[model samples]
Target chain A: MLPGFPHAEPLAGLAGGILIGLAAAVMLLGSGRIAGVSGIFARATGVASSSMPRLAAWAFVLGLPLGALLVMALNGPLEPRFLSLPWIAVAGLVVGVGTRLGSGCTSGHGVCGVSRLSPRSLVATLTFMATGIATVAAINALT
Target chain B: MRQRLTSEALVALVAGVLFGAGLALGGMTDPARVRGFLDLFGNWDPTLAFVMGGAVLVMAMAWLIQPRMIRPLFTDVFNLPKARDITPRLVIGAGLFGVGWGLAGLCPGPGIAALVIEPLSAAVFVATMLVGMVLVRLFEKDA
Candidate 1:
């Protein structure tokens, strides 16, 4: 277990994973769409568009915060410390562009795409995981 | 057609809600938890591995069921990615996203879900991410 955090919540984490899977299943079965959050956000925000319906994209993006709010009401808010605003802003910028250019992220490539056994998603997941680990190590080492 | 569109939007909203709620319950919305998962060389917390395992297991089953279906329930076509090539864009973009994720401990889904939990920081991240995505779009269009 990592220090400076609460005890590991494996059960909660697994339960949440199942819920996320169910959500992805719903999207795939109901709409034949990948539940890729970055892509959906881009579509909703008009940064990117293809054949996806704009209304559905908007609805999905809007619902993300509502679901989070519901969880907060039930279990109380999550206390996540962040880096300084300037640094976080820069990171966010990179994430936004990177996810767009890469064509997926945790939800899109990691969960949905990997399950489908897409080689592209697999490679992307591996790439991101490696870099994510490296970045964390670098940060811990430096500070 | 209008009725179908409405149902599609509703389904998308429900999917997003479940996805966000899962992210919260699974501790993905917590930067500490996420960072712990990434800190493989440190006092690593392996709970997120279980989370991903559980999600991937369920989604794998979904992929099996997907192929059996004639088409999606709401839409006429299944909008799935067909590209299998691992392009430089995928590797580089995923690497960049990984850096940002490690630095901020948030991805698109969690970043959006944390809007209520850490409104200011999350907003900054999301806003900058959007700008980044838009910049990519502009550059791509020019290219």
Candidate 2:
């Protein structure tokens, strides 16, 4: 456990993971779609088109915050520190372009794809994990 | 047709809410926590592994069911991605996304969920992300 934020909640993490999996399962079983956030975001924002209806995409998008709100209602406040707005913009811009080009993000590739044992998703997950670790290591060294 | 559409939207909304709540519960909505998890070389937070483990385990089970379903409940056909080959684009794009993720600890799902937590900054990040995605689309069209 790291300092400043001690008590790593593996139980919470596991429970949350189960919820995420259930969400993905619901999506796959109900709508026959991947619960890939970037894909849904793209379709919702008219950046892409697919068999999933635009209305459903928007509904999914709206529900995200509502769910967060529900959790806050039950569990109280969350303490999440964000980067400065400029840094955030840079990061977000890169994420958007990358996810679009790559055809997925963490949820799409990491959770949903890896579970399916899709070789492409496995490759994508491994690539992102390696790069993410390397990037953090570089930042840690510089800082 | 209208009823089916409504059900489809409802399913999507429920799935989205669950996804968002899971991220929040799993301690993923916090960028600092995520960054800590990424910092494998320095003070690591390994609970993220539990989150991934739980999610993947559950989703792996879901995949088993998915293969047996004739059709998803709300849709006529399943629309899962069928891409199989690994390519430069996948590797490059995933690498870029990982960098951005490490930089801000915000991927698309958590980025969107952060709307409730940090509205202004989240708005900026999300806006830039959309712009970047659109730019990629434009570039793709040109290419």
Candidate 3:
């Protein structure tokens, strides 16, 4: 295990993942939608419209914080340390545009699409993984 | 008709809650944990991988059940991505997203979820992200 870094929480990870899947499943089976946050955000913000309606999109967006609150209630609040504001802004811009251009993010492509064995999602997932790995490696090396 | 919308909205709210909770519980809401997952060359944490795996496994089952059904429970039709052929937009977009994800260790889901945890920074990232999405929409329209 890596020193200083927390040990991998396989159980919590798996449980949380199952919950994610359940969320996706509930959306798919109940609403016939992909629970992709970027897409949902776009829809919620009136930037884009998908098969789902705007009202429903807003509901989902609002639930995100509520759900996080639930976790905090059970496990306590998390204290996250983010990068500098400028760097974060840059990253956010790229991600927003990229996800739109690409058509999906981790939730849509990585989880929902891949689970369905979608070729496009597969390619997108592979591409992102490769680049994510490379980008992290570069960042680590440069810093 | 109004009742239908309300039900769908409720479903979406519940799904969003689950998705957000899952993200938090799985540690995806933590930027450091996400970055650690991407840090393959260094002290890499495999927690996110398990999270992804568990989510995929369950969602796969959902896909299996989807094909058997004529329509989704709430919607009249299932809205799924139709792109099959790989294209430049997909690859380039995915690449850009990966870079941004690595740079900030944040994505759409976690970014929103983190709003409650780190209000100011997360808000900055989310605001810029919305701007990016709007930029893409405007560009696509002109093109």
Candidate 4:
């Protein structure tokens, strides 16, 4: 694991943010589609179709793992904190609902929406972020 | 459809950087933190919500400004998805996402974002997520 920071490293976070912005911009500019993860995932699964969009979507999705592999190869090894299978399955279900409800996942609204400056995206993004925040708060309160 | 390769590459690079930075700063790069937030009915970490809120604030500003400034970047016009009241699809998708997130503590963007810091689990989460996406597509096609 990377060295843990005391409060959250602004530099590290900034770097991460830059990467997301760059990725979204590139996907749009090059492929002419928003780098929305749900859409990408849907297309990859064949639930949705758009030849060029699908290719780019696949590339983006595949690149994610490839990038992780590169990091793992270099970093030695990393282990995720384990959670029960049922819990993981449930979490997946919630996120799926949220994505559909919000009309886009974080990648689409949070990244692409902000970049393109869409009002509807703004509201949806706000709702998403808010809901996420509330969920965390409630989770924390109960736990 | 064709543009200068260099410019396209630059866009991709920038988007990636921004995306990565956001994940890192939001504390989303850490599954432990995500778990903490989801452990709400249990441990109750509430920080993720705040981070999401901050992101929404930035997005809100962008939404207000985008249409006024840029008519359209690549497409003839920016296409907005139809605004539909929350439906069963929304509920189902969000619920699935939450369950996965609570268990795995990683959403697609943040999960992929974690690659910069952690690799193994991130890889697993991303792979499974893709599988889920593909499954959705296959089922949809059959329907």
TM-score of chain A of each: 0.93, 0.94, 0.93, 0.82
lDDT of 2 by residue, B1-143 (tens): 89988999999999999999998888888888888889998888877887889889988998999889999998888999999989999999999899889999889988888799778877887898899899999998999
DockQ of 4: 0.24
TM-score quality measure for candidate 1: 0.96
For every candidate, what share of the true interface contacts is present? 0.78, 0.80, 0.82, 0.24
lDDT per residue as tens, model 1, B40-116: 99968777886788888888899999999999988888998777889999999998899999888889998898898
Using DockQ as the measure, name the better of candidate 1 and candidate 2: 2
Relative to the true structure, candidate 4 has a C-alpha RMSD (angstroms) of 5.8
How much is the lDDT of residue A85 in candidate 4? Answer: 50
Provide backbone clash counts, one per model: 0, 0, 0, 71
Instruction: Report lDDT (Cα) of residue A104, candidate 4.
Output: 68
Error of 2 at A99 (Å): 0.2
TM-scores for chain B, listed for all candidates? 0.96, 0.97, 0.96, 0.84
DockQ of 3: 0.83
True lDDT of residue B95, candidate 3: 90
Show where candidate 2 strays beyond 4 Å.
A1-6
Worst 10 residues of 2 chain A by lDDT: A1-10
Q: Candidate 3 has which clashing residue pairs, if any?
A: none
DockQ of each: 0.78, 0.82, 0.83, 0.24
lDDT of 3 by residue, B36-128 (tens): 899998889999998999999999999999989899887787887777989999999999999899899999998998889888888988999
lDDT of prediction 1: 0.89
